[model samples]
Target: MTIEQAIDSVKKGCKAKFDSTVELHINTNLDVSKPEQTIRVSVVLPKGTGKKVRVGVFASKNVETAAANLSESDIAKISKGELDPKKEFDVIIAEPRFMPKLAAAARVLGPAGLMPSPKSGTVTEDVEKAVEQVKKGKIEIRTEPNAPLIHTVIGKRSFSTADLAANFGEVMAAINQAKPSKAKPDWIKSVYISTTMSPSALVDIPDLA
Candidate 1:
């Protein structure tokens, strides 16, 4: 189907009570067994992800204190488990030096996708900028470790068709830019868009091209 049709289908399929997030799913032709073919990266959507992101920063006290949005007190709260990683924050950003401290909470943060990593731009020297970017709708996109599919939220079902289409275009651009050197020309196999509880609508790859 055309991109506009896919977006319209996603909006129409949302039967959930809350504003369901519109998600983009891409299946690639990469071999999941090969480490070199793995895809992992982040991008800032132009229209934002249409989700409120609570950011947690792991950094030295000095850096936290210096940070404009993240405060030292907040870091302390996270470290002490006062702020539950899963419930309190949607994403976590950390400085390289504080990665060791973050390791201790891996069991709690890892499964929730709240762990900071270099590939996601969450592990950075510039903690303040990272936090700001995340607050402004920076999202990470990665192929599943065991599958060739990549999934990410593009926007909410409440968004207008134009807004969703714009966000969808940004995600496609980022995915194309992230094509691994080892991947073939037809690396991207299929793309779909859907709301949280709706069946997916297939998007025409040629139109996106």
Candidate 2:
């Protein structure tokens, strides 16, 4: 099925009481063990993710307008299990200098997929811009730790099919652009779209080479 048809099918199949998140799942052929084959990058969906994102910033100094300003002590607390970042924010943006400090909390944040990294544009000198991007539907896409599978929320079940299709196109474009230099010409193996409570609908994979 095409993206539009798949999205329509999934939306029709949604039976949850509340708005459900539409997700895109892709299977790839690259072996992630090779550093160059790893795919990790952030892309802004033009139509947005259809949900509010709570952004937290970790910096040496306070950022006046940041949703949540995290300090060195907060990082320490997270490393020691005294703080649970997941309960506070949906996304975390960090300054380059603070990355070393975040390492201690990696054991805690990594598994949750909230750890800030340069590859995902979460580690940068400009905290404000990063926060804005995230709030405006910027999302990180990466393959799973032990598999060549990529999964992420594309939009909401309530969104129009056209809007959902637009967001899906942007994600695919980003993924294609991030294709590793050494990856095979045909990197994507399959594509599927589904809402949180619905069965997945297999869709034709775009030309991602």
TM of each candidate vs. truth: 0.86, 0.93
lDDT of 1 at 60: 59
Q: Could you tell me which 10 consecutive residues in candidate 2 have the lowest summed lDDT?
A: 200-209
The lDDT for every candidate, in the order shown, is 0.82, 0.89
Q: Which stretches of candidate 2 lie over 4 Å from their true place?
A: 206-209
What TM-score would candidate 1 get against the native? 0.86
Q: Whole-model lDDT, candidate 1?
A: 0.82
Clashing pairs in 1: none
Clashing pairs in 2: none
Tens-place lDDT per residue, model 1, 1-209, is 99999999878887899999999999998987898888888989888887777776666544443223444455566567786767767877778887776676676677788888988999999887887788777899988878999999888888889988998888889888988998999888899999989999999989889
| Model 1 error, position 90 (Å) | 1.2
TM-score of 2: 0.93
